[model samples]
Target: MLKRVEKAQQKWGGSHTVIDNWLNERQELIVLYCKIAGFSPYEKKDQSLPEPSQIQAFCQILMDYLSAGHFEVYDDIAKACEKKGLESQQLANTIYPRISDTTDIALDFNDKYAEVDAEDLLVGFDNDLSVMGEALEARFALEDELIDNLYSNHAD
Candidate 1:
């Protein structure tokens, strides 16, 4: 995820302020995700689920990131495509429903685990996390493609 975000930044950073800020948010979100998932190298090798408070905090950041992508980033891209009369609209129309489905899964994951204590989460938590992680990976790939299209068509 970090690698994909870095590639996106390298390709599209500085082309527009919105894209730069969105990429920065993506970096922050990934860091939070890594920390929660115990994927941070700086953290210990304990692959246990984080505490309830940590999960709740992560959920907050996740919601914010999701909201920004839907409300600000996607809206801006659609407006830009409309302004430029680009066929990106068709791409967006194809991708948006799938992205929304992924968003639903993410939000469901957040709601399910946000308030779960570490002890309770130990039961079947790994499977839930695995599903959420896969959904997120797919979501990120779709989002990156959307960003690439937006940048290629509209960035100056």
Candidate 2:
């Protein structure tokens, strides 16, 4: 997951400020996720389920990333597509609904963990995080395709 995000950042990093910011937020989210999951290079000092604060922080970044994509990055893509012609617009149309499905998954994750007390967090956290990770991975791929196809024409 981290490798994929890094690849995306390398591929599209400096194309636009909005994209740069969005991708950076993605990196942050993934790092926190890795830490929480006790993944390689981020093994926790204590093996307990992640602290509520960590979940809250992750959710905050998650919401920010989602908002920036919808309100800023995708808005720019839509505007660019208008100028890029019908094909670009059609590509955006085809991709947008799929991305929204991933968004729904991420939102469900946020609702599940954003404010749960410590005891409540343990019930299905591993499964929930695993699901969230998959949704995030799918979303990143959709986002990369959105940029590669739509923004390629918009490049100056």
Provide the clash count, candidate 1. Answer: 0
Cα-based TM-score, every candidate:
0.87, 0.91
Off by over 4 Å in 2: 45-47, 153-156
> What is candidate 2's lDDT per residue for 3-24, written digit by digit as tens?
8878878888888898898888
Clash statistics: count for each candidate: 0, 0
Could you give candidate 1's per-residue lDDT for residues 23-137 as a string of tens digits? 8887887777777777857365655567777777777777888998898889988787676654778888889999999899889988887777756736766677778778878
Clashing pairs in 2: none
- The prediction achieving the highest lDDT against the true structure is 2
